[model samples]
Target: MMKKWLIVIVFSLVALFLAACSDDGDKASGGKSDGDTVNLDFWVFGSTGYQELVDEYMEENPNVKITINEGEMNDMHNNLFTSISAGSGAPDIAQIEVSQVEKFLQAKDQFHNLNDYGAEDVAENFLDWKWAQAQTVDGEFQIGLPTDIGPTTMFYRIDVIEAAGLPTDREELAAEIDTWEAYYEAAKKVKEETGKYMTDTPQLVYNAIRDQQDLQYFNEDDELIMEDTVKEAYDFTTKMIEEDLIGQNELWTPEWGTAMAEGTYATMPGAPGWMVANVKGNAPDASGNWDIASIPEGAGNWGGSFLTVPKESEYPQEAYDFISWLTAPEQQLRSFEIAGLFPSTPDVYENEEFLATTDEYFNGAPTAQIFAEAAKSVKTVYMGVNYAIVDTEISTALVNVAVDGADPQAEWDAAIERITSQLERQ
Candidate 1:
């Protein structure tokens, strides 16, 4: 009877030890069962060709698999907000546009503090302003890495400018139109001589000028700052219309497409990607006639995105590795060479291959070098959460001023009211 009791006691002890081990393993794996493969979901705004780039990285590492979920810009923003609020199956990695950083940074704890993973060294390679956009109010670094940058340039048709008796070469045009005042003068000359407006619409001109500003729409305390900047943008655009330098057309409509295709506009200030798809898609026949130059201002950036790791990710280290690799200087250079997406890495600007390359689409002009020079001079600004709302209201106000002959000061006041109201709700 004594031996039988000892055997039973030993068996019970063994069972308890096994249960403890199982519980510990569950905690370690974030409730995932043993022997299960770890899958990471990555979300991007659109088909940005990151899958092909990531596939090459995965081929050497079989332990990790990445699944990309692509959606429209607005849809992706909504999805991120919903998933984050629910504390549910959010993506391990997500792309956040520069303009939306303020919104996401508000929930600072929802994202992994990237500084803990030695991302600070990588952050040093980017421009000061670009890197600052990823940090929270308390100075906690939240985002992963910046993949591409928006260094705006004036992409023009060499043939069109030549026909208008304007400077056709990049250097001459850059020199002639060094300031916004000079740019307006050139626009008037182009319109009067060739009957082609310098831009597609008043909003386009306003957007370009607004990008050149240090403060837009709002102040440091998030109060509406539209009175001065919006007034300036509206007055400038309205003057362009009054001076017959801007063509009257709706943006993104069939009429706009027709105008671009038929050379109704001579120049457009936009990012490098616009040259690849939007402009090229609209006017494929005018390929070799196009070229890129620095914008009226020395430097300005428009749109770009950063990859971030969410706090709920099961595999934070893996996500960080992938995000860092994707935004590394070497990888960004490859992306620029393949997709015409400009590199955010300052070191990539020194690359001889990037600086020397010429595009056949732009009459073999060395556009890479031109953009690289412009990217260096770009000044960064703090874009707040209600940037979109303010942008929309201001655009509407500008349209009224430019197209409807509305009073510029009155439109500016009205825009201030609307933008301030919208931002206050946020």
Candidate 2:
């Protein structure tokens, strides 16, 4: 009787242990077990004001944990490349700049196709062009979700314009400078009257004109095309430089910030929505003196980013869920308010609250409405994998001509040669 009782006790203990093991296995596989947890790591460059949103997300999702790692733009992108090449240590989520997207899409297999996670159902949530940027050429696989878009506009100092004897009203100024030629005339007047440069740099002018086109350095076939349109921009930028209508300050430099604060430049044309925050941050004391107008000859894009999940992510589904939620219309609007990241989600463009928003930093300009309109008007352009490399060479040539008085034609030819060489190597 004692032996039988012991045998029953041992069997019962084994059953309990097996049940506990099964529950643990279920939690490990991301089942709806009460104790299941999903941890995600996010890598981003620059501030997008995601911390607060993540806090709210965590509050609503007690079983999920998220950590954000912020790094410089170039550093972050380089690290992402290294991690992907190493086949480990990649972040669950990464914010890739618009220019870098094409490069990464070349190795699409490294990223998880978000389509597997119901990406198509939410496809309509973002702009068609934006949504397409992260998809395969055949439109089968998708790797990222759209985030912010940089809709180009002219950010100017109202006081400086008034000093130049130009229209101060946004609508009036916009109409007055409707075309690039009209803009150049205004710049001449501004320089003549205020003795301040009308634009930041020759490269900026070139970038604005280049961005206005539906076609850029490359065509849909990923073939290089250096057409007359690009040369026109280059020639026009050199003309501005020869006329001394642009400043010598390089962007992202301390000298540039000082020049902006001191009203050394009257206008910053072809700037994007995010530049509003940069302007305010760099020139805090220049508050209430600035305003925005539409970019000359319609809107162009400057900078934007998308959030992607790598295949190495242990929790791709959870990462996608968080990103999809984070970029939803409501959350995008909130991010805009917090970080001046213009929404890529068109649904927010018509929101009454968004349209009504104004900024005293820009002299009560209806900033949201202006940027929204520009964002909507932006023409989609094809930037191939080597767009950044080619663009860098061209901009470097422009800088050389602007700063060191390099011969324009020679520099242009050299830039082309350098771009050709790089592309050949690639």
Candidate 3:
């Protein structure tokens, strides 16, 4: 990014020199006049397909030129954090993942509050939970505009379920596993008929149930709610593990791919679109064997992102203009069309094209509508600044019990202690 900026500066200087060297009338000689170009430095992370979008935006607005630097999500976030702390070298705008967004809330003042630029007026355009995630209590000091949302839906292996003598129909299977209890019973039947497990691992099931709850680890006031909701979620996860319904494989690993390809699991409880894509990508040989369904209980989200303008940006208004346009309903729809990033905008849900789209990977299933309905139905969760850390602590507790034969009660007590200790330090 620095090198690109230096080159732009040199090019501007050469343009000034050429103008000055030209023989003109008594009019103002060639020296660079006031620069009108809004050169914005944008850092995008992950497979957002923003490069093409930025090219389109630049072509439409010749006066504005944006330089996009892309990298992995973790790298981009680390760089942004360093720059923010150093008070220099930050990009005009950057992408932040939902899980990591809470970390920035502690330094909220470092961002250009989108609310100051009239972002609240279009709040209805986005899904309520996504919009709420980036704002303060009064909707003041909103630091980001919602982009792609990850609404949870079930993905299952049709062949595996059929092999277990379960209904192969999507709606019928949906009814069969409409609740966690039903899902476990179905798992038992599947295991009895065939040696395959019901799902990948206990942690995912734990997370799926935890995400759906109104309060998982913390309340809106940042009070810990472990004893009430978290304990129950853990207990359910432990029961599944104890019953041997879950396979002992890590997500997104070679073992996971092999399991999918071999039809070792009958169902995935609820997953984001990208995670479902991950499943499909890893097991392409199993094409036409997998499909999506409604989440057993209801909707929950596991992934998404925000586009934020930093306070250090010299072109704040122009940057905001670019992000607002990028995250707007029309552009979000384009993104989904290009990259499978489910739109956060509810208005796009009514688009006939989106509703009618089907996936061959799921045997021409109407996954588009499935995801859109789940997107709107998601409950709003007010995660505190300590969410990532606290959630990880609890997740580790589940892992300990599953892998080490640790007592569930003991693990739960340890998780609470870790969360309280870590959050207090934060």
Candidate 4:
């Protein structure tokens, strides 16, 4: 009877130990279990060519499999918000746009700090300001790695530029029209000689000028700085309108496409990501005539994205490794090839392979050099939570003043009032 009781107690203890081990295994690490075939779920939006990179990663590491979930930007952002709120159902890694980064940063605990994995050590690989966009308010947390940047450049019709009696050579043009005043003078000549507008709308001109300033619409504390810098940008754009230097077409409209194809305008201020596709889609007929140049005065970033590892990932280290590799200098070059996803990494800027390549659309101009120079010079601007909303409102005010004959000062006042009320309501 003593032997039988001892056996029962020993077996009971063994059973409890086994149950505890099973529970520990259920808690996955970083998105994978140790010594098991690891599967990671990645969320990416648009054709960033990240999915292709993932396939390459998996091919090399057969034990690690990744599933990609692609969604429209808005939908992806909404899903992220939902997942973060629920504290579950998030992907191992996700791509977040610059416009949406601040939105997510509010829920800082929801993401793994990339700084923890030594992201700053690789900071030299990317443009300074572009890399700065991924940090938290205090810069204590690095949440993401920059994927691509939209450094605004002037995409022009070489023929139209030459016909206007302005220098068509990229170097000469950059030197001669290095200032907004010089650019405006050239625009007047283009209108006089070719009767084609210098730009499609005042908003683009506003963007070119606005991006030059160290600040846009708002200061560091989310305060309005309209009377000085903002007003100057607004007035300059209005001057173009009052002087008849722009075509009256709104952006992304059928008329805008028709104007572009027909050479109704001489230049398009393009953000790299949108420009490459826009030219291919809307102005295909002007293939060899198009070329790119640095924006007058200075360069400003218009769009870009970052890749992040969410806190919900069971495998945070693995997630970081994947993003770091995806955005590594070599992979960035590959992405630039697959899509016009411009490299955020400056390491590739001086690479012969990158500089040697020329696009047939830009008349075989060495565009990589022009873009690289612009990307290098971009000023570090702090984007507040109201960046997007304020940008839209100001664009509307530009149209009103430039197109609808609204008085510039009154329009400026109206914009301020509207934005103030909007912020107050929020």
Candidate 5:
């Protein structure tokens, strides 16, 4: 009887040990599986067919799941700031505009340095200026990849030009208007012949010209550099108003929309995507009459976005892998084909499909080729953290000068004073 009881006790101990080992095995498997099934949150500003692309990626990579959160352009920036400050519930990846990059980089410690994840070496794939926008003060990479870039183009109505008896073909226009000086001359001709304004607003021209400069309101040492290039922008905009090339309506208002539909403006120097969605999408009936051409000054970048990972993310490696894939040249090409975003990768410029593509909305013009060429020559500019504030003050000053007929020199002096004071306070 004692031997039988000892046997039963030994069997029970063996069974208990096996059960404990099974539990440990299950825990280990769960931990490894969690890495494969990482749940990533991503944020972007546009309702510009991003969901379809995300859905396609999920279909291809079933192991990973992405939840996308979108908001208005300005609201997304505000949300990013607020969420990063709290350091909790922040998205793994976020889309940041070029204008806002400097502002976000000021709180540099809040974001994962992409240089640590091997983003620095691949910088050669993007435009040099665009690549620099993602670097921190110490030359550390804070942004992962450039999703899109805006190489400016002049989207004009071919029919309108013909009606106005102006040059219709790209070559003719290019020959007649090789510089901003020639551009204004062509605009005067269009106005006289077609009775339509050449542009929507003087401020739009100002913004486009301002983006072409290599240095904005500040320098590398953070000192205000408010001479030369900036003065040129102000002077050019003032001349546009003095020459009556632009209508007085503010952009984004009902007045602007009405004028666009009514064909009050003959040409618009606009971002590639916006030119499609805003001008062509709003007036689809007017399709086949519009065409795109290179900007007068050869090329310049306007707006684009970079994807960044917050430092507090729980899965940095997974985030980096996903980001690298999404912004890869092939993936960006695919995205551009589906969406109207121009490619940021340098290699895409060589792809025949990218260079030869035509938009039905723009009278079947090979706009992609024109924009790609222009993007190659784009200049890099340093936009300091306070760029938005300074830009706003300068824009307001321009409005006073052009619209309210305020003294050009006096307005510029006051604007410089106000911007300098504001920067000091910050």
Candidate 6:
């Protein structure tokens, strides 16, 4: 009877230990057991070429599943804000545009600090500037991983420029219009000779020039500082509008597509690598007639995005692991090949495959090499939380001057006043 009781006690103890181990395993996997599936919801705006990657990831890790929600950039951002305010309904992971990231940083508690899941170990994988952009001002918290970068360059129509009696070779044209002043002079010649506007809009010219500055609307300390470059860009754009050297077509409009197809504009400066897709998609008939050159004198970044794990995520570790893998150098290069979204990983910039990339749409221009050099030249600038707000006001003022015939100085003054008032309210 004693031996039988000992055996039974041993069996009971073993069962309890096994049950405890199973519970611990489930907790570690965010309440899912090893054999159970882990599902993640991902939100993003625009085509990031992530669906293919997500499919691959699921195949490799059959225990995990991911669903992606694609929406327009503005609508998705607004929806995210609403979800965050509701304290529920947020996706496990979200993609935030570079300009808008600063705004989200203001509500940092809503995001998981990626450093908690070994993000610091992969910091060297991305460009220094891009990596810094997602971190807190004190560098204590990181909200996301860099996905893509926008390095500006001059995308021009080969035949339109040649028709203006200008050099068509990339190097020759780059040298001829090496300065903004020189660029404006060439614009005049293009208008006078070819009767085509130099660019689609004066606002684009202002954007390119304004972004090139080492300082923008705000400093690292979050102080509003409008540098001389901003005024210069404003004046330059207004001068183009006055001279009738720019087209009235707003970007993304049907008229803008017509203008590009008909060669109404000769060139678009400060265009990012991703613009290659827009040009190809909008003006398929004009293939081989277009080419890319370096932006005048220097380069600037225009657009990019980061992937973040929201604090509401039940599986933060899984979300981090997936994003880290998705944004790795290899995947980023693949994204470039698939979507023309330039990689933020500098290591990918030197990859032989990346270096050899050329576009038949741009007359086989060494598109990759040109953009890589431009990306290297871009300076690190701090975009404050109010950067986008300030930029919108300034852009609105520019339109008032260019379209409504508002006085340049009066509009500038009013914009400054409005930006100050808005910032104070926020």
Best-matching candidate per lDDT = 6
Q: Model 6 scores what on Cα lDDT? A: 0.89
Question: What stretches of model 5 exceed 4 Å from their correct place?
Answer: 1-36
Q: Estimate each model's TM-score.
A: 0.91, 0.92, 0.90, 0.92, 0.88, 0.93
User: Model 1: residues >4 Å from true position, as ranges?
Assistant: 1-36, 403-405
Q: For residues 1-426, could you state the per-residue lDDT of candidate 2 as single tens digits? A: 999999999999999999899877654443445676778899999988899999999999999989999999999999998899899989989999999998888878898888988799889998887787778778898878899998888988898899999999989999999999998999999989998888877767888889899888999898888857898999988988888999877778898888888888777888888888779878999998889988789988888899999878877778889999999999999999888788999999889989999989898999889988887777778789889998999989998988998999999999999999999999
Candidate 2 residue runs with Cα over 4 Å from true position: 1-34
Number of clashing residue pairs, candidate 4 = 6
Candidate 4 Cα errors over 4 Å, as ranges: 1-31, 270-274
State each model's CA lDDT, in order.
Answer: 0.78, 0.87, 0.84, 0.82, 0.78, 0.89
Window of ten residues with lowest summed lDDT in model 2:
25-34
For model 3, residues 260-347, the per-residue Cα lDDT tens digits are 7888889887688877568777887887999888888998998899999888887677788889999988999899888889999999
How close to the true structure is residue 177 of candidate 1, measured as C-alpha lDDT?
A: 84
Preferred candidate (TM-score higher): 2 or 3? 2
Higher-TM-score candidate among 1 and 4? 4
- Candidate 6 ranges with C-alpha deviation above 4 Å: 1-31
lDDT of 1 by residue, 48-161 (tens): 778778788778666678899899988897889788888986899999988888888877678888887768877778777777777864556656578787777888878778
Better of 3 and 6 by TM-score: 6
Cα-lDDT of candidate 1 = 0.78
- Model 3, residue pairs in steric clash: 19-30
